[model samples]
Target: MRGIDLFLTLVVMLSLGAVLWPFLFYPLILRMLTTRPEQPGQGQPPSASLLFCAYNEAVAMPEKLANLAMLKRRHPQLQILAFDDGSSDDTAALIAAQGDLVTLVQGPGRSGKAHGMKRLAVRARGDVLIFTDANVLLDAEAIDNLLARYADPQVGGVLGSLHYLGEGKSATASVGSLYWRIEERLKDEESRTGNVLGADGSIFSIRRALYPDFPDSVLDDLTVSMAVIFAGKRLVKAKDVIARERLVAARGDEYRRKVRIAARAWHTHGHLRPQLRRMSAIDRFKYASRKIVRWFGGLFILTGVMAAFALALRIAPLLAMVGVTLALILLALGLRSKGGPVAAVVDILIAYAATLQGVFKAMSGRTVTVWNPAKSR
Candidate 1:
């Protein structure tokens, strides 16, 4: 009975820690509350490169290029590079039609986004490299807002705010959008105080000198941003600089994305050990709280529930009943096709499960480099 009690206590503590780790951003929040808005930079604009990777985005490519063209008008010094990762669609032709307006790189087949980015970097001439996706729409002032932080010599990267464009009033979309809001708020605070663990892949910029030639297995956003932090440079936020992308509408698509992200995160964990040790005390804490704990948290949740059930059977039925009831509620929502508060709970559970699978795959020497864009958007 004593051993049982101890096991239950350990399980509960682990579960609670997993749940509460996100609140670690609160201190950074307090710092932001005391700070004032920064003035815009007055220095001449540095040579900047806008880089993007295209898969099969023929329909969206023209509009995206138009936006970049307008941005180019505003900042003539900006250079643009586009790479088509073996797209079977008109993506290549559209890029070819751009002529001298854009520099097109021959992507060596569908070698995945990380490899494509590495290839593009070799040809980038700008002191600052802005990486983004083809699907996201960037505001005209986004570049200006991002470059503003370069005025500070220590700032190595700037992450732009990502806002999700809802397809309709679906509950699933709401849940995903709400999650992004919470994530962005945490990132905002982290950027205000120190460094963001990673940047929004839809829109982020870093100094060309700080670029890490990450292997194809790593997530570009997390790898590059963390590399900046590990290099003893700060990453700041430009919330006014916004990029928009449509939210994935289906729960299954969302699940797959979480799985892919988790798998890459697990890969990053092992690959970055040396750099992790080089991190400052505060940055180390941030990485552990933001990345490590969350990756393996699903196991804690599962263990906590099993232990709670056993304890309830022996001595605490009421607490066990409450846990069981909540679990059922989440389970039912997860099985459903619709979105709501229950669906949100279901999404969280799915994410936790994906994290477990991702970690397991990573531990077993499995690596996932190629990606299939979810069709649910």
Candidate 2:
């Protein structure tokens, strides 16, 4: 009985620790170890080529093109390139209408962003390749701010800050916004130390020459950004290179999006395993702490909860049962209401479950390659 108690206690603590360490302890440790400042880049901004892959984004095309035109006007040398992934809508037509303002690549079919990005990389003549999504809008000086970092020869890739809009509109959006804030903080600490783990596809740039070939099913932004580090260069995040995007307002849409992202992220990890093994010891620690631990966070959470229940049952079976039943009832009510603390908790659970599903799906030889913009976003 004592042995059982010890085992259960250890399992509960260890499992919970695995899940919480990334968010709580990792950043603290990172800050304590970080000694250097961000590379204050010098010299003129480099020429840039902006690239995005779109599919059935006709509604967003006009706004995106106008934003691009503004950026182009400010930097006359900035090259704008886009790929229409066989959209059934007027996406390609809108770009075609832009004429000289944009360079367009129309795919024969629904080739994924990885494929479109490869084509764009091949055609990109600028010194840097800036990758953004169709739905994400960049700030006016985002490009200039992104390129300004390139003045430091050590900086091979620059990740832009993504600020989510409409957090108060829905529980899903609020949860996402809070999560991204933590993520941005982690990225800041990582940048000060040595390298950021990787870039978000929403907005990030890499030296065109450093863009590496990756499998279509892999996460392109992660693969491309990590290649910068694999080549012995720094991948840093620039807070000033800002991009704004709306959060997925619907819980279901947000859940599916995370599932897809998590699945591709796992596959991308497998593809980059070789280079990952060769990274510096500290970087390896950061990767394992930030990425690997979080991938299994759902499983850890489950194990922890189960162990807690078992321990509670050992102490008082009747009270444990009553407590858990009440908790479940509360959770159900919260989920139905879809607002306030309870709803946010349920949303987080949904996110973790989705992440776990995606990880296991990838592990079982299934991978997500293509995705659509979240309609609610």
Candidate 3:
């Protein structure tokens, strides 16, 4: 019995370590080993399509159009197009109001963003397709910076840098911003070394010829980025091409977004698994460690909770109590702090919870659809 308990404890610790190492430790080591090079000046321009997918974004379309017009003035030759995903709002009218600065496509019904993107892809006339959200504001140089990476012929896709513009002193916004900073650092290092696992949907560019038509409900960026990688092409992260957006005001808003993202990830895992055998060993490890394990972190947390409970009843009650108490302390600290020590702790906990929620949701054969609006903080 003692040996069995020891083994179980060891297994739990190892599993937790496995999940944390890539997300937390790997970046630290990579940062120490490499530094991002200075971004070069704007190079030769490539004909590109700035694709925006909007869903009920009437309230924000006017601002988006203004930004697009600015981009057009700067890029001059760049083509811009947008799609309204069965929006009940006046989004279509707003796009129509933009005239030729933007082209508008209306979906037959409310299919997902992926469907809208596929529709847009068919009409895209540029050699490169840059996808961005309706609410995000791109800096004047963003499109230029993104296109410059194509100077490297081996680069198939480039990810835009995302910055969160949170309201005055919101803890949720603070934590989210900090999390993205960490993600950016990791991607920067990954790009320097030659591979990026995925791209954020807020902004990312891919070769039009390399574009893969994804299912309407799939996580579009992940699917498209991974497809580029698996095609023997390098997907690089462009730290200089920045896009800025306000963080969803409320923690609930972030949670709802994460749930949809996790659900789409689950679907992506099924479709991409078969291709695993064909990937290089390094890529296989990266996908498994960075993506697969992270998605299941919540299950590990639940298991740890169960194991702690069982151990408390069987033996080493003090150790189990201490562990639980420590976890609570971390959670409390995370809630109180900005993007500092507490935020890191809180992110780990959130990752665990989200992962666990996704697993149970999958096992119970429950499907998550319909967006739940998150409260603004």
RMSD of each: 2.8, 1.2, 3.7
| Candidate 2 vs candidate 3, TM-score winner | 2
The segments of candidate 1 whose C-alpha lies over 4 angstroms from its true place after superposition are 6-10, 24-42, 167-169, 316-330
Better structure of 1 and 3 per lDDT? 1
Please report the candidate that would top lDDT against the real structure: 2
Ranking by TM-score: 2, 1, 3
Give candidate 2's error at residue 215 in angstroms.
1.4
Task: Report lDDT (CA) for all predictions.
Answer: 0.80, 0.90, 0.76
* Model 2, runs deviating above 4 Å: 38-42
Question: Candidate 3: where are CA atoms >4 Å away?
Answer: 28-43, 167-169, 312-348, 359-377
Give one clash count per candidate, in the order shown. Answer: 0, 0, 3
lDDT of 2 by residue, 1-377 (tens): 99999999999989988988989999989989946655565667788899999999998889999998898889888888999889999999999999789999988898788988998889999999999998889999898788888988888999999999888988888999999999999999999898999888899999988989877889998999999999998999889989988888998898898899999999999999999999999989999999999999999999999998999999899989998998899889778975799888888888999999999999999988787878887
Q: In candidate 1, residue 71 scores what lDDT? A: 91
lDDT of 2: 0.90
Judging by TM-score, tell me the better candidate of 1 and 2: 2
Give lDDT for model 1. 0.80
Q: Per-residue lDDT tens digits of candidate 3, residues 61-137?
A: 78888888899999888888888877787888989887789888988877777777888989999999999988889
TM-score, per-candidate, Cα-based? 0.90, 0.98, 0.86
